[model samples]
Target chain A: MKRLMAIFERDVTLAFRTGGGALNSVAFFALTVVIFALAIGPDRARLSESAAPILWTAATLAAMLSFDRILQADFEDGSLDALIESGDLLSLVALAKASAHWVSTLLPLILATPVLGLLLGLPAHAYFPLMASMVIGTPALSLFGALASALALSLRRASMLITILTAPLLTPAIIFGVAAANAGARGDALFGPALMLLAAMTLFGVLVTPAATAAAIRFNTD
Target chain B: MDERPADAGRLIAARDIAAQRGGRLVLSGVTLAIGPGDLFILRGPNGAGKTTLLRTLAGLSQRAAGALKRSDNASVFLGHADGVKAALTARESLSFWRMIYSAPPAIIERAISRLNIFPFLDQRGASLSAGQRRRLALCRIVISRRPVWLLDEPTSGMDAVSIRAVVDLIAEHCRDDGAAVVATHEPLDFGPGRTIMLDEAA
Candidate 1:
């Protein structure tokens, strides 16, 4: 518990204290969604139809933007070397880092999703479902983002690689997330099943992300 | 955990340990032993593989050639990067490390005063000078209370006073039955420590 809190507290403090990356995530998320809406020429019907998937995609990319923040700083600054010296500590740090990333980056976007929802012509019916699906799915984003951070720690440029690799992996979460929100807005009966799968994906991430990320970090330590 | 007793009655041995970095063999044919109350200095030229040896000893990297053995307790690695985040205050950073190391709170106070970091404990890492950052990084040793310290160029970018303080801290840590392997080009005033000099890299 102390170890987890140590990582969590410091990350949160830095996230708010610097006031850059966290805000940038929300801004990037909002901008991407808005631009998509505008680029489609402000047709409310088409905009509403695409809004849920676009928001989900924007959030995923924004989460990736800050993926390097999870372990890159530790790797570059040699903190990860110290933390990973202990066999057990690396896994704990991985879990703590993923939790911190969600709290710092995704929480803000979830809070701001309603406004972005309105701007993108999301129907009133979709607001809660959008928020609910994001709440369920965004943690997976942070978890996989940590995994990507570890995979890319030893490389010079990794974002593009991360996108190519994780896009196929994240497809299911994105599909279920968008399906839930779109169905909720359009009063389709698949909403409950979609949301259930979204939540299950987040739970699955909670179980596996730590070990995967820790192994990646350990590999990079060499 | 392993339930092994702490650093007491423990020894770390390296026999013909070879290390590589960036796909090139840097150091080879090394042997040493570190026990409680030991102060071991790694003296070599810039490319003599001092850092690589330290990393191998710390278990941060695998040895390419021979075997390395140490106590069940892990050694702490302090590298050139200070590990101080620019957004955090000195005190906050120390507290964070304290929590990570599972150290007592008293160590934080002692380290802060011993290093004379109280003047800027509340200041952000970005606002500190290079020497100050180095000093803060050295404090992690005091905070960790770990049995073994693998320090790579620990005193770089520090003034005379700061260097002296670090030397004293290491000496004090040794007196407390702790061991240290410090990798550096410059010699420090740590008393009675054996020096392992490395020749050209292989």
Candidate 2:
């Protein structure tokens, strides 16, 4: 438990440091949303209609910006080897890293969703659902992103590989997240089911990604 | 989860061990044993599988073929990379490892002083010199309190004084009944120990 906390604390501290990449993720998310709004013009109805998908997609892409570095730093510097030698389960270390990534990178995007939603002209009714979806959905992003990061560890052009590998896995979270927010915006009854599915995806990611990530890291290190 | 007692005689033993890197055999037909107070030196030319053998003994790489046995004593591996985080200070790195190993604070203090790390304790890993970074990484071995140490080129970037400090540290570790397998090009005096010639192993 102490070891896990140490990993988490160290990762979080690194994420906030210069060249840590967490701030870049948030900046990318905001810029992507703003660019979409500018490209879509001042058609409030059009912006409102597409708000949920735009935000969800931007969030997913932003999360990807930081994924490549999540385990790459540790792997390159021999920290991963030392970590494995620490006698703790690699799965636990993976969990700590992913959780830290979520907190440092994804959580900021979720927090900024409200402001981005305003820029998108999203309906007030959709606000809660959008934030709720982000809250529940981004963990899946971080979890699977960690897995992809580990899979691509030490490879040249690893960021591109992480994107290609993670996009397919993240489709479900984006789908369910956008669906939940759109349902709320349309005043339909689908929000509950959509949010539930998003939560389920995150829960499943929590249950499975750590071990999968550990296996990937083990393979790469070997 | 080997249930053997900590005081078991042998630390590590291997016979007919074969190790591979990049799917190619780098080392083969090796046999050795390590016990308490043993300091085994691995010497070889580059690409002669010195690093591969250290990594294999550390269990970081899979052995292509071998009969290996360990006595449940935890071993620490220090490789070519220093494993220092650029964002963290030297002190922070040691404290973090100390926490990970659940090592007592006294050991960390001892390591910091013995390795002459106090001068750069607050310097971030990115700013530390190669030798300083190596010293910080070596602290993990002391903080780990593990009986067996697998070190690769531990004195690569150190000056004469730092090298002596490290050699004395290893000698002290061996005197305390701990074992070490050091792979290095530079000669270090660890008193009495066997030397494994990887060129011959290959």
Candidate 3:
């Protein structure tokens, strides 16, 4: 627990103190939404109708942009190797690093999503569902992103490889997230089931991805 | 020297080990019997797999074929990278590592002062010199107080005074029943340690 907290705290501190991690992604997210609005032109009905997919895609992309940096920084600086050798638990440290990434990047994006939604001319009703879906769904997004971050270690240009390798895997979350947000926009109860599925995906990623990442890190650190 | 009785101390042993990196064999038929207070120096030409051997012995890398044995739980491995975050101050970085190793604050304070880093304890990692960064990394190994210290080129960037300080620290660590495996080309003052020579794999 002590070691895990150490890993977690250090990552969060670095993310905020450094200019490039969370805020960079948030800035990218808001800019993308603005560009998206200007490009599509401001037709409220058209924008609200398309808000769910646009928002989901933006969120996923923002999350992806932060993926390659999370574990790779530690790997590059030799901290990952030290952590892997520290004690008996590699998975715990992996989970901590992933959690830190989630908190630093995805959590901020989720907070900014609703405000960005207003920019898309999304109706107030869609707000709750969008945030709800992201709250549950983004865990899986961040988890999968961390997994990709680990796999990217083996590649020469990890950032280049991250999107191509992880985008397909992220499709289910995007599909379900858009579905949930749209249903909630229509005041339908189907959003509940969609939310549940999203939560399940998060849980599955939570349970499985850490060990895989730890193994990949150990293998790649050498 | 295998002259002493084998059962006299703590042991971490690797036998008939082979290792490959990037699908190419880098080291093979390597064996080592490391125990407490052993300051083993690894000497070799560049690309001779000295780092690979230290990493393998530190349990950070897999050995392709090896029977390994160990009775110690505390081992510290220091590779080329210092693992300092440019955004974090020296104090924050050391505290974070202390939290990880569960080492006390006094140990960290002592290690910092020992390395003459009190002046820059609040300096960001990026602002510190390479030798200072190396000192912070050494401070971590000292704070870890692990029985086995595996350092690769630990004193590469330090001035003579700093190098002498590090050498003294290693000697002090070994005096306390700790063991160290150092890979370096510089002549060090560590006393009467067994030396290993690694050759580039065929």
Tell me the number of clashing residue pairs for each predicted model: 0, 0, 0
Indicate which candidate wins on DockQ: 2
Query: How much is the lDDT of residue B140 in candidate 1?
Result: 83
Query: How high is the CA lDDT of each candidate model?
Result: 0.83, 0.89, 0.84
Kindly provide the TM-score of model 1 when superposed on the true structure, using C-alpha atoms.
0.94
| i-RMSD of all predictions | 1.7, 0.9, 1.3
Q: Which numbered prediction scores highest in TM-score against the true structure?
A: 2
Please identify model 2 stretches exceeding 4 Å from their true place.
B1-8
lDDT of 3 by residue, A147-201 (tens): 8889879676577689887899899999999899888889889988999999999
lDDT tens digits by residue: candidate 3, B10-95: 56777788887766789898877777778898998888888888888887777888666666565789999998878989899888
Better of 2 and 3 by lDDT: 2
In candidate 2, list every pair of residues with a backbone clash.
none
* Candidate 1 C-alpha lDDT tens digits along A112-150: 888988887888888988888999988998888888888
Please give the distance, in angstroms, between residue B178's alpha carbon in candidate 3 and its true position after superposition: 0.3
Off by over 4 Å in 3: B1-8
What does candidate 1 score in Cα RMSD to the true structure?
A: 2.6
Descending-DockQ candidate ranking: 2, 3, 1
Q: What is the DockQ of each candidate?
A: 0.69, 0.81, 0.74
TM-score of the second chain in each model? 0.92, 0.93, 0.92
